[model samples]
Each structure stands twice: as structure tokens, then as C-alpha cells.
Target: MPLLRSNTADKFIVDRRKPHRNSDVARAVRRSRDRLSQRHGTPVFDRELLKLHAHAIVGSAATIPLLVLIITAAGLLGGMAGDIVVWAFLTMTCYAGLTWVAHRVRKADASRLNTISTKRNLLAGHFISGLGWVYFATLGCVNCQVEQFPIIKAIVLLLAMAATALITSSLRGALLATFALPVAAYAYIGINSWAPIELVMTGLLALSLPFFSYVASHFNRSSVMLLSFRSEKDALIAELETAKSMSDEARRRAEEANMAKSRFLASMSHELRTPLNAILGFSEVMSNEVLGPMQNPTYRDYARDVHDSGQHLLDLINEILDLSRIEAGRYQLNEEPVRLLHIVEECCHLMELKAHNKDLRIIQEFEPELPRLFADERALRQVTLNLLSNAVKFTSTGGEIRVRVGWTAGGGQYVSIKDNGPGIPPDEIPVVLSAFGQGSIAIKSAEQGTGLGLPIVQGLIHMHGGEFELHSKLREGTEAIAIFPASRVMEVLPALPTRKVAAGGRRR
Candidate 1:
């Protein structure tokens, strides 16, 4: 009455475990990731690092000139505006050269770059800039009006060191190369002056240089890591693309093969059936003694066997054609309003002779006064007969086969045919339900079957927007239920009200 669940097979269960087919692709991706991770200093990433260094220098091009202007303005307050201007001019000239080199490098292609040579040139430029700072270390006026000029100069040098570390972080060893000379110059000038403030500043600058260099190195490593992650992401996307292409290729081949099979079967239907019908006709005449009595009884018996074998072959051919039509989406449904109970009952009657032969008893139960079901009448008949035949064929002698027709809780209609046959194993339910598939019991039985009964039934039910469920348990029994939705169960319409016209040809 509730949603009649198929307990025999866990058809709705999705298995998360699947055989992995992309091991080679996965291994290649891993290998690529590992190689990218370790190849930071190699030619590929070296080119990337160079490009980043160039961009960093060019992007913040205004900062250096601005710092120089501020320093010149501060020095002008020393009253030696002439010396201050000269220093600014020379320093500005050095920075202008550095900026030009960075801009050129940024525009240069990978082919033009020699990583080692380019790095050396950049390092030399930084060292030249360091010479400018060396001059700054000794440029302060001792007797100037400002008392903290030395401290200001020391702070300025430290600031410059910090900025250079940030700017050249992408290019390895550039920070140390730039500030190495300046720190030495500052320390020498400080120790000679014998000023505690200068000496203390000098020691601070000495320690700060290495610290800033380490910071730059750390930043460079971070850049390498970012590149690694980016490369891995690109690799994954590429692998996905390759997989998609391969899948498309396989699908195209499969579709082509399916089309070829359809064409072959279409030709074979006429080819095979023409000869088979001849075989059946000749065998039937001989078996029935239609022309005359056979001379030998053995000859008559052989003719009967031939006729039976031909009939079986014909059944198998018909089943194959029906399944193909269903699978190829060519099986169109001719839906009509029909009695569900009557059709199932009739199918039971049709199969009664076969059940009687097997000494099996079929019990039929129908819900009375059920509504007409909208379905393909022929398909419904075939579905019921297939199920019934399977029951009669497999059911043991004196076994009871129960058939029920009733309304579902959802107001839908269902027909269930259950038999106390040597039941299907739980694992074999799927096999039995597949086209040309048989269970171990069916295999061992003396009964001959093409094994397409349940599958054809399932296809027919599906065509009518219904569910076909096969329930079975080892040694207990098997039940095959075909359920049609409420939509297919046509409701009885209300009778129309009639009124007579009063002396006119019009109805009120």
C-alpha cells in the first residue's frame, strides 16, 4: 500500500567505490607537481623570478625618486645646498639607470634572457646603488644646526635597506649585494668618529643587513611556493581536459558500434526468420501428419522435436528484436484505457495450462471494481505473460503461485506475481533482471529460457511510466511486481447534467 519497495535488490544504492582507470594520468600529474615544487631555481622558475623582479622594480618606480628628494630636502637644511644638490644629482642618476634596466628586462622575452647573466647584471646595478648609500654614510655636516643628523642618516640607511629587501625579494642574493658595501662603509666611518651614537647605529646597521637579506630570501621562497601551487592547478585542469577528450572519443566509438549492431539486426530479422518460418512449417506438417502418416514413429518423433526447437528459436529471435527496439528507443507505446485486473487475470488463465503441466497451483487475488488503467494493452499483456511464464517454468511441483492486483497507497495500480519456486539468490536478482542473463537455479533447471523475460517486462512497464520490481530470496520464492502510477489510473468522470429546451431548439 505504501511505496511498494523492491526489497530483493538494493537498486537505489550507489556504490562509492569504483575501479580507478586513470592511474597513469594520476601518476603523471603527481610527477609534474613534485618536479615543479623542487624546480624553483631551475630555468623555468628562474625566468618567472626574473620577470617578477623586473615588474616589482618598475611598478614602484616613483618610490625611490621620492625618497631621494626627501633626503635632499633634509640635507638642504644643512646650509650646504650646493653639496646636497650634487649628491642628489649623482644618486638620481644611479637610480635612473637602475629603472631603465628594470623596464627593459620587463619588456624582454624569455628567449632573450640568460638567467645567470641577467641576475649578475641586476646584482651589479644594485651594488652601484649601494655605492651611492656609501657616500650618504659620510655626507652629514658635523657642525650643522641639526643635532640628530647622524641618527637621521642612520635611520635613512636602515629604511633604504628594508625597501631594497622588499623590492628585490624575487631575485635571490640581490639584497645582500646591494647593502653589503654600505654597511661596511657606515661601520668604518662610525668607528673612526668615536661617537657612541654612530657606533651603536653602525652595529645596528650591520645586524639589520643580514636580517633584511634573510627576510628577502624567505619572501623569494614564498614566491616559489605560490608558483608551485599555480603549476599544480594548471596541471590538474590539463589532465581533466585530456580525460574529457578521451571520454568523448570512446562515446563516439560506442555510438557507432551500436548503430552498426542495429543495422545488422535489422537485416538479420528478415534473413533468419524467412528460413526459420520454412523450418517451422515443414516440421509442423510432418509432426501433425497433415500430408500423410509417416512411415516410422521415430520419424514422427524427430519431426516433433524439430518443430519444438524451431519454435524456441523463433521465441528467442522475437525476444532479441523486442529488446533491441526497447534499448534503441524505437519502441513506441500505443496507450489505451484497459482493465488492469482483467488483463492480469487473463494472463494467469493463459499460463494455467503450463502451471498444470508442472503440477504448480496458481492463486489469483484481484481488488474488485478497480478503475481502468491507461497503458499499452499489448505491452501490458506481454509483461504479465512473461512474468507468469517465468513463475510456471521455475515453480516446483505442488508449489503455490500467488497473483495479486490492487490499488497502491498512492492510488496507483499494481500486479504482483509471486511463486514458491527455487528462489533466486539475492546477488543473482540483477542477473535475472538483465537481458540474456540467468541465475544459477535457472541455469540448473531442465526448463529452457532465453532469459529476456524479466528485462522485456521491465522495459514494457518503463514505457508506460511504471516500475517493475523483482523480489526474490534463496529457497523461499520470487515475486515480480509491475506498478503503474496514479496518473495512469484513470478516474471515473461525473455524469453530465441534461436539461430540456422549453418549446425552442436551444438547451438551457
Candidate 2:
């Protein structure tokens, strides 16, 4: 039943809302909407506007006690605080309702946020709070002759208005409506007062309205920019995560394909080698006339050719198998202590005949008393032989090939094979190093090769914790160097002295 999918497709939507974790109350209060608007622009997101409304509601509620103290001190109630009490009660109730709405919004799913009804509720709360402040501003102590009483009342009203503006400044429309009503009421009351000092105070209050508006605008802008930056940052992080996932998947697939190729090669090599061995054996017998002499000389030559061709094919297969084993991590090295001088001399002696047949000279330079190397002797011999063979194959008749063995500057050992042949071009160095890749010169010359020689050598040297480098230039020469690390270089121990038994039969 679970496997039987529904006919209707399920809609998937990405949620981009970020969690709000900043709870530094002092930072929030200091980042008043007035200051933000001057530095930036009004918040573009509706959620930001809702947040500002909530802050304003809370700020107004906090100022209620202060309002009561000022009212009582001014003696504006004439011993009848009933009117002010009722106004305060209504203001508190409006704030409590706004607080509940804010809490609901904060708890609501992101999908339901920024709805039309939510904005309407927030604006209504702001309007009611504004009206409460306006009433306080208009009903000040008119009968009090004491100068400080009216001043204190005005100060309290101004403070409340400033707090409302700062809190709601994230939303331009909300802030304007909240502060404009109270400021206008105060201006009206001041202008109507017959006292000269009242007129002066009224003028000052009227002048401050524009400054308050400017501050509110700046605060709104700053909040908008901050919110926009956070949104952009979240988007970039999501994109990076997606890219990383794609890259990991691609790498995994590539590794699987490589393993499959290695398995196929291993299977085919075994199958092909069996038939190749029979071909080489029969051709060699016919060429050598093991049973009877060939009736014609041409028949003998043709048989010899067949044997040579088969031998070449067998060598190619062996190279391929070696490279595949190395790549598949199946090649095991039989490690032992090998003298560098001995291995190089043996490889050179084996390739000497081939060089002489081509009329080329083999030059040898050995660093005396070189330390023995801890490595696979067979692998080292193959690496040396491959380099020497390549040099002999590439060099023209009468060219000189130099082979050198020495201790490296860092107390390690190295082998260098240099040939005065038509050298490899600079661009083809990587091609020469890669498997089955032959240089252009080798391809065009009489002697061509399956490009596996250098790759095998490089792989073997790497297994021994050594480095192989091929340096060449067009028409100049080519040099191949393999350097073994110091860890693989064996240290010589001090010789023990032989003890002599002198006059063993004597007691002295």
C-alpha cells in the first residue's frame, strides 16, 4: 500500500525563513528606527514591519507607569484620578492585545506570515496607542500656576512620543501615524495657551517634529538593508551546499567506472596471453628448424618475422597488465637491499648490444662508495632498462647516451640517463609521461613504441618513495632522472675487528 503512490502530486516548497536568534535587548533598543532610517531605507519585508509594531507596543506599555507618576505629580486630576485611570486601563488593554498578536505571529509558520489581516491588526494597535498619548498631551494641568508642573507634563508626553517613534521606525507608515497624532495634539494645546512661556515651549516642540521624522526614516532604511544582507547570505550558502553535493556525486561515479575498466582489462589480458604463448612457441620452432631444415630460406625468414612480431605483441600485453595492476593497487613489491651501482651496471650491459648495433656509444658515470637502496630490485632494474632502451631507440647512429649514478645532495641516491637524440618537444613532456602516449618524434621515427614504458617506470619509482623527472628540449637532448628518498638509503655499519689467539697453549 505504501508503494502504491497517490495520483495527485505533492507540492514541495523551500522555506527561506531564517531563525531569529539575536536577543541582545540593549542592542535592539540602541538600534532605534530613527537612527536606522538616516543610514538606510525602510524595511522591504512585511515581517520586519510587524516586528517594529510589536516593539512599539511593548515600549508604550512600559511607559505607562511613568505617565502615571507625571500625572500625579502635576496634580492635573484635581484629586480625581478616575479619568486618567480609565485612560491608562484602556491603553494597557490595547497593549496586551497587541502583545498576544505579536506572540501568535512569532509562533506561526513562515508560510502564514506577512498576511493582510496581520498588518491590519498591527496598524490598529499602533493607532490606539497613539490616541492614548494624544489624550494625555491635550488634557494637561491647565489650572496649575506652577511653571514646572506644565513643563514636567510636556516632558513626559515628549518622552512617550519619542519612544513610540524609535520603536515603530522600521515601518515608515506605522511610525508616521503613531507619532503624528500626539505631536499635533501637543502643538495645538501649546498654541492655544495664553501664557508667553507656553508659546515658547510650543514653538520648540513644533520645531522638533521634523527632526523626529528624519530620525525615524533613517532607522527604517538601516533595518531594511540589514535584513536584505542576511537574506542574500542565506541564499549563497544554499548554493554552495548544492554545488558540493554535485561534485561528490561526480567523483563517486568516476571512481566506480575506473574500477570496472581495471576488471575488464585484467580478464582480457589473461585470455589473450594463452593464445599468444602458443603462437610465439610454434613460430620460434619453425624459424629455428627444430624438427627439419626449411625447404626454402624465405620460409625461414618469414617464420622468424612471425616469432619477432609475436614476441613484440607479448611484451605489449605484459606492459598493459603491469600498468593495470599498478593502477588497481594490486602490484606487490618484493623489497630488498639493492646496490644502485650493480643494478645500473647490469641494465646498461643488457642494453649495450642494442646500442652498439645502432652505432651509438654508452657512457657510464658511477658515484663511488654509494649506499645501497632498500627497494624492489626487479622494479629498479626494469626502470633503468626502460630508460636506457628508450634512449637507445630514440638516438640516431653515432649519438652518445650518458648514464650516471650518484648520491643526491640530501644524502639520497639517484640515476640519470641523458641522450643526445632528437629530443622531445616541451609540450609533449606530459604526453611522454602518460600511459600509451609516445612523443611525435618517436611516432615519426623508424622505431615506435606502445607509450607504457615511462608510466611504468614512474609508477615503480613512486612505489619506492622516489621521484622521477624527465627534462628535455627540442633538438638539444633529453635527461630522465629518478631520485630515491633518504629513508630508503641504507647506512653502512662499522666493520668488527678480528680476534687473534696468540700462543693459546702457553699459560702466560
Candidate 3:
């Protein structure tokens, strides 16, 4: 079935292009698959049209012979019964041949059938049958006294033309081939007799040929359009199938690559960590002279540098792995009820010494008696530490970092870490939030970072059905807010009323 249809597309236009060069062999083998229109007419459309004409003509076969029999009966009212019978027999025989050809063509394989030859034979059959009408028009009716007999003959002839026009319309020139001769004979007979009724009948017949042809042209256009639409629909379906297969292939390759990445990281995690742990341990022991006093002071400095470098490398590795796991959806949250205030307070206390070294002050503010939140406690601690570290790193001497945990406008819980540091530019906020993306301030500052801190925080908050927002202004401060949704904000139940039961335990 066609996927599209229209009612206002009854225009007659010819396709004058040559045969398509692409897929010629395929179209020849299975004409049904042909989607191209060509000068010689599309093979599928031509075959379909021929099949249509054949089937229509075959379907109405019984009626054609009846017309001939009626004409024979009419002509019999005249004095030439024997001649009329012979003419009717010849006409019926011609029609029988046309029907047989149509039936054979219809039953045959459309892909192998010769459309050109079949059309020629059908046209020839129609023309031969018209000769019977010419002979009947000339037959004399001496014994008959019926007036307006010419009109009756004209009506019958017109009816036949109309029926033929509808059936053979798809086969170009078939209608004209059949009726042209009969119309000419009528004109000739009328001119010789010079009778009024005969002349009118002849004129009517002449005019109807073109009118019927015009109407038949519309039918032909409709058939071709239907075929064209079908071809386009098939082509679109083929393209969609091709695109879907390509998408599937791409997704399969991506899945395979992700799996390979996961395996590589999983193995490298143990292998790399083993060495980093050793480097940090030995470097710490050597720098601190845990085993013995160092002979040279320079050796102690070298050990400290090695330890610092190793620690930095370790931090980078951990950040990269965390970001990867979060992005790959492998970081499962150990969800439990944890107080947000305790986590932030502990992180502040931990960073207190580092903040004091830089002459920075860390202040903690909590909404009193805040409810426990459903989240991963370790992740919350990491998020708090990362924010406080950034605050200390970016703040100038004696700058203050304010940590606040409070309720959001939507009845949710939010932890906001605000630092009065050399604030980041508003436009660079996105750069700061993306994985491994640092801003100009961080690049210029002495402090080092993996730049995955904000992204990891965002990911953790999002996994808990929450939102993360970062607001900043130049020369002012930057505040990073992680909002947990109302769903995760554990509701506090009201204490049950003490029952003052006097007798029974079942008190209301």
C-alpha cells in the first residue's frame, strides 16, 4: 500500500527522460523494484498499466458480445437479416480475439511480458471491431418505418466509445484506434444522404471522440501518478532501513570500545596503585629520616620533591578514574541516611590547618537540626572536601570561606560553599564545571588541580536526584550549591502521643 495520497493532483504531464543507467539489470530482472522514471516509460508502471487494461477488459467481457447481439437484432429489422448476421459474427469473433488476448496477457508474468507488442495487438483488435459498426451504419432499413432510428444508433455507438475509453485508457491511442474509423464512416454516410438527423448524429459522434479522449487522458495521468508515488514510497523505506542498520552498527562499535576501556582501567587501577603506594611510602620514610639521619641535606630535599610529585600523580589518577566511573554510570551510590551538616563540618575542620597556613578562615553555618539525607556518605564527604580545598586554594591571604547547609525553596536540602577568592569570570563558569576543564584564574594561580572536581560533584549530586549550581562574580566570590531534591530529604515524624490508659493497653 502507498504511504501517501492526494486528491488535487490530476495534472497531465509527461516524463521525457531516458532509461535510468543505475540498477538497469536489477529493474529488468524484478520490475517491481524499479523506482526510476524514464523516457521509455518506467517498466513497472508500463507493465502495471497493461495488466490493468487487460483485467478491466476481461472483467467486462460478457457485456461486449451482448452489444453486438443487440446491434445485430436492430439491423435485422431492416431487409438484410442474413448480411447483418454475418457482420455480427465477424464483429463478435474480433471481440472474442481481443478478450482472449487480454486474458492471456493478464495471466502471464508481467516481468517477462512484451508491453509494446501486446498494446499493438489490442489496438488492432479494436480497430477491426469498429468496422462492424461502419457496416451496420450503411445497412438499409426499407421494411422499417421507425423515426429517430439514427439517434438510437448514435446512442449505442456513443455508449461503446465511453466504455472503451474507460477500459483501454491506460494504453495510449487505443480508444481513437477503435472509434476513429466508425466516426469517419458516419460522416461520409451523412454527407452523401444530406439528411438532418444523420448529420446531427455524425457531428455528435465526432465531438465525443475528443471529449472522451480528454477524459481518458485524465485516467491515464492518475494511473501513472499512483505508480510514481508507490516507487517513491519504496525508495524512502529502503533508505530508512539502511540508516537504521548503520546506526545499529555504530552503537555496537561504541559499546565494544567502552567495554575495552572499562577493562583497561580496571586492570591498570591495581597495577598503577601498587607502584604509587610504594613510591609515597619510601619517599615519606626517606624524607622524614625514619630509618636513619641523612648524611646530606640535598638528599632530604630530593626525597620530599619525589614524594610531592608522586602524590600529585596519585591525585590525578584518582580523579581521572572517578570521572570515568561516574561518566560510565558504574559509580553505584551506597545510599544511606547521613547528616549533611556533620560531613561539611568535618571537611572544614580537616582543611582548617591548610586554611590557617594561607591565613584563610573557614566558617560553618548549619540550619539547626537539619534532617538526615538519603545519599552516599563517602561521596558527600568527598564533595565537601573538594569544595573547601578549592576555596582555600583560590582565596587571597586572610580571605574567608563560608559553608552553609540549609533548606531550598522547593522544600529540598542544599549545601552551599562560598569563598571570597579572586572570583572567576562568569563566562568561564562552564569551563570550570566540565571534566578536566580549568578556568584562566586556575591556570594563572600557583595551585594545581585535576579540574574534574566540579564535574564529579555535579555527577554525584545528579545521581541522587539533585541539581548542582555554581554562581560567581568577578572580584566578589564564587558560591557552589549542591541541591538534593525533596524526595531525598528525610521527613521527621512527629512523636506519638503518650497513652494515658487506666485499665487496658488498647488506648485511643
Candidate 3 structure quality by residue, lDDT tens digits, 145-202:
7566677778888988898888777778888988888788878888898999899889
User: What residue pairs clash in candidate 3, if any at all?
Assistant: 17-39
Q: What are the runs in model 2 whose C-alpha is more than 4 Å off?
A: 1-96, 135-169, 194-214, 222-224, 500-508
Count of steric clashes across candidates, in order: 0, 11, 1
Question: By lDDT, is 2 or 3 better?
Answer: 3
Distance from true location, Cα of 2 in model 3, Å? 61
- What is candidate 3's TM-score against the reference? 0.70
lDDT of 1 at 146: 77
- Per-residue CA lDDT of candidate 1, range 47-158, in tens? 7788889999999888877898988887777665776787788777887778788888899996579898888888888777777787877786755687767788889988
Residue lDDT tens for model 2, 1-508? 3687665433332222422232343343344332333323222356655664565555455565566556554454454355566666665665566567766665665445654777777767667666766776666544545554546546765676576567667656665566577777777777776666767666666666666777877887776777666655655554455555556656655665666677777778878989989989999999999999999999999999999999999999889889988987898999999898999999999998999999999999998998788899999999999999999999889999999999889889999999998899899999999998988898998878999999999999999899999999888889999999999998898765444234543536
Tell me the TM-score of each prediction against the true structure.
0.81, 0.78, 0.70
Candidate lDDT scores, in order, read 0.84, 0.75, 0.82
Worst lDDT 10-window in candidate 1? 11-20
Query: Where's the lowest-lDDT run of ten residues in candidate 3?
Result: 9-18
